[model samples]
Target: MDAPSNVVRLPTAAPRKPNNHRFKEQRAAGYEAKQASVFRERYINPRVRAVMGDAETIMGIEQTPALLIASALFALADPDTQQKAMEQLAPGAVVGRKAHIQAIATMRRLRATTIGEQYDFYNAIDELEKRRS
Candidate 1:
């Protein structure tokens, strides 16, 4: 075992710990942005444009409502937020009733699983009617 005179042993470096936090956050943010873009392209923009219809109408109407609806749709994609929205809007206040109707319609159109079984469309309509009185 003494025939290794010409061989040199190299020292091994210590294993480096993975710093995944920054990369993970960056990746998550990127993925979220991409998903949001896709959602806008596929659903939000089309609906908003449909409501706008033409240049004159688009210029006449405020963009805030469409933006709010899109934001609500994004938030409603989360189950917890969807539940909170349902609870918050169930009391039939005028504004809440309108939001409830919009949310239900958006959920149905999107085929969102988050609020699939939870929202009652008829009850929402009744609440809206009550609020209108």
Candidate 2:
């Protein structure tokens, strides 16, 4: 039978109920997740209604491409260029070192892409294999 005399057993705790005891920030974020976003209502709707006379109007095919190109240009632009884009709200330099650097980088990337079109990776790999042998 049992020979141990110094061993002590303690009661185990129940599994943690994290959901039952969420932090204030976690609870607030959970509540926010259930709500619809007000982005269009706050920004897009007002401008669209003012210009087009309808907030429900769709950006048609012609406007869609222009919007896409504008987005791409914005993506390529630096912080200064992006700020100048919203010049009415926040005015600053028309161009800066950041803009110049981004422009040069974008042009270099474009040129590299154009050059990469003629590159034959399979042939290059074959040559590498021959060199290794």
Candidate 3:
């Protein structure tokens, strides 16, 4: 049988493996270490100091969540926004309004201190929202 003259053929290449191993190694060496230090310095230490203050009180079980809520609210820039976020996160919690007020006071006290990048704070809140869902 005679073949048609308009026939075309395409060439294929072998699939290449991803070079993700090197990327993981580099990230572990640099990014992870840097992130750990930053997290400890910026988030954990500050929250601990805020909760503990100069005089140490025995940390009760209930105090952990309270401290966390306060810290998250304090991270926000505005009182109304913090209140709204708290309301959204804990619809009927009694502490929502109180946390908002405390957050406002904290914000005022730390007004001169920089809060790092706004995007980072928003991203953290987004992640927390996702976890709640």
Sort the candidates on TM-score, descending order: 1, 2, 3
> What does candidate 3's lDDT look like per residue over 56-129, in tens digits?
21211234687667666566547676556545645333354544444443443433344543333334444444
User: Which should have the higher TM-score, number 1 or number 3?
Assistant: 1
Lowest lDDT 10-mer window, candidate 2?
52-61
CA RMSD for every model? 17.8, 19.4, 14.3
Show where candidate 1 strays beyond 4 Å.
Answer: 1-77, 93-96, 111-133
Worst ten in a row by lDDT for model 1: 51-60
lDDT of 1 by residue, 1-133 (tens): 5539887655664356556686788899988888878465434233233332222222333448875687567665676766666566556644545545554444333445335233443334434445458
User: Candidate 2, which segments miss by more than 4 Å at Cα?
Assistant: 1-12, 15-61, 64-67, 89-133
Per-residue CA lDDT of model 2 for 76-130, tens digit only, reads 7776765555453222223444434333333322232333331432233333445
Per-candidate TM equals 0.25, 0.22, 0.22
Q: Per-residue lDDT for 105 in model 3?
A: 38
lDDT of all predictions:
0.50, 0.42, 0.47
Clashing pairs in model 1, backbone N/Cα/C closer than 3 A: none
Q: Which candidate is the best by lDDT?
A: 1
Q: Give each model's clash number.
A: 0, 0, 0
Candidate number of the best TM-score? 1
